[model samples]
Target chain A: GESVGLHLPTLSVQEGDNSIINCAYSNSASDYFIWYKQESGKGPQFIIDIRSNMDKRQGQRVTVLLNKTVKHLSLQIAATQPGDSAVYFCAENRDGATNKLIFGTGTLLAVQP
Target chain B: EAGVTQFPSHSVIEKGQTVTLRCDPISGHDNLYWYRRVMGKEIKFLLHFVKESKQDESGMPNNRFLAERTGGTYSTLKVQPAELEDSGVYFCASSQLTGSNTEAFFGQGTRLTVV
Candidate 1:
């Protein structure tokens, strides 16, 4: 079975510093990728997404970088804040799979003020 | 301007019991999906609905799980005679359309605990 995994299970960063979370996926056929933020006892919230054709996409304060050559994906957060403390997950969607998303084992981000 | 919403944020039932989780997607969104994550695992897809019809259900775990999207408004996932393995967090998501590039909005999720 194909799987998506994160390089780190936990990350701690100081406020105002940059944070990076990495993911590796097994399926080369996946064409769409997304990043989601999940707080405790809550559902995952959409952050940003990038297509396989592009290398990077930016949102309000988040950026998603995709390296197809290595099947690696990363979510970079600029000027991290306390509100940014949450679990981040990277999801991949296969080309033919319309609405199915395969999520990675999440990285827990802890922002220290 | 509401996002996806789910009902019964938490559920605890004994084995062999039945539980139903509900989801209300964003207004006028035509795509709906179901996903779940068991303890210490990643989130996995369950099924998808396009409008009022089931577009894909290959991710459904077994026949004991049933999903319905009547009127294409709200969707429900019913687990009958649930087993201990069914304990997990079930999430529902929706998108404006069904495409390879569309971003999906997720609900708060329903956490089920089977005793």
Candidate 2:
């Protein structure tokens, strides 16, 4: 069985500060990873994604780091804002699959305004 | 383009009852998927439809769950004799194609509470 898990269940940060959430996955066969932000009562929203071939990828205000050697992935948010408070989840997809994503237990990001 | 849309945002049903969840994928999207989160657990894939055909259903929990995509348009997930464990948020997502790099657009999800 393949599983993706978070290192922390909750992370708190001050507004304007940087936040980093960590995830560890067991399936080395996974070729793609994505980070999603889920607001309360809303569906998980796409934040950023990185292919296993790359070590890192950057988005508007977010960055995703992948460490295949350690089977770890991280999502970093710069200048965290109040609107950034949400549950963040990491998902992995295998190359040959039909793009079905396996999600990890989310880490709740709490920004103190 | 409109995002994935699901009907009856919330439903409360008794045990052994039946319920159907509908999902309308983004227009022109060729890939649709259904996932579920039970209680506080992580979201798990239920099945996937590539157009009007089921491409993968390996994650479906049991035979009690049936999914359909008649015209490769919208899709439906039906659960009969729903059990207490079936109470959770059911999410529908769509992507432009079936590849490892495509980003999925998700719906708000249907919250099913089986008592």
Candidate 3:
């Protein structure tokens, strides 16, 4: 049950290499973006987040880049590892709206050793 | 502090039958939400509850889906006369703040299968 879902755009990378996953959002009013990782049989777990004010934010081994002009978001992982193999999702939320997250179809990151 | 918790990790039911899924949010979280991913689709919002009142239900698909947070402590989603399209993974999440995109804690989703 460690598989989020079988149907997702997959990115295969060698262990120790950098991995990048991208997403496109439609809402122009969305002021915050968050990235999540979902393993099999589990819910989406929060990874990192960035507000609309900042173009980039860095966390422990993770970086989130946001481009409000183009409404694009990307997550970069420093090193690919077996444990990092999971479905990654990007979610957006607009200010003054219900605090519900609008999620994108996830990308599965597969680490190849 | 315990994270969000969901009941019945998995369920299989016949079409037109009834299924109820429950979720318990973190002790002090005031905002609770429900989302689901059907088949190969992305997770979509279902509803949101603030305290005992439903803050927003615009994402509810149809009348057959009913959600309630009786005491503002726990919530339940009831799918009556469920259809094949109702089959999906139901996830519950809770956050401490509203109007802000703070991190939401998610529970292990409940996978519902309709045959």
Best by DockQ: 3
Candidate 2 per-residue lDDT over residues B1-115, each given as its tens digit? 6789998799999999999999999999989999998875899999999999899999999999999999999999999989999988999999988888888999999999999
DockQ in order: 0.48, 0.52, 0.66
Evaluation by lDDT, superior candidate among 1 and 2:
2
Assess candidate 3 and give its TM-score to the true structure: 0.96
Candidate 3: pairs in clash: A2-A40, A3-A40
At residue B11, candidate 3 shows an lDDT of 94
Clashing pairs in 2: none
Error of 1 at B83 (Å): 1.0
For model 2, how does the per-residue alpha-carbon lDDT over A18-91 read when each residue is reduced to its tens digit? 99999999899999999998887889999999998999999999999999999999999999999999889999
CA RMSD (A), model 1: 3.8
Better DockQ candidate (1, 2):
2
Q: Rank candidates by DockQ, best first.
A: 3, 2, 1
Candidate 1 lDDT, tens digit per residue, A10-76?
8999999999999999899899998999997788988988899999998888899999999999999
CA RMSD for every model? 3.8, 3.8, 1.6
Ranked by TM-score, the better of candidates 1 and 3 is 3
Q: What is the TM-score of each candidate against the true structure?
A: 0.92, 0.94, 0.96
Stretch of 10 with least lDDT, candidate 3 chain A? A1-10
Candidate 2: stretches off by over 4 Å: A1-8
Question: Candidate 1 vs candidate 3: which has greater DockQ?
Answer: 3
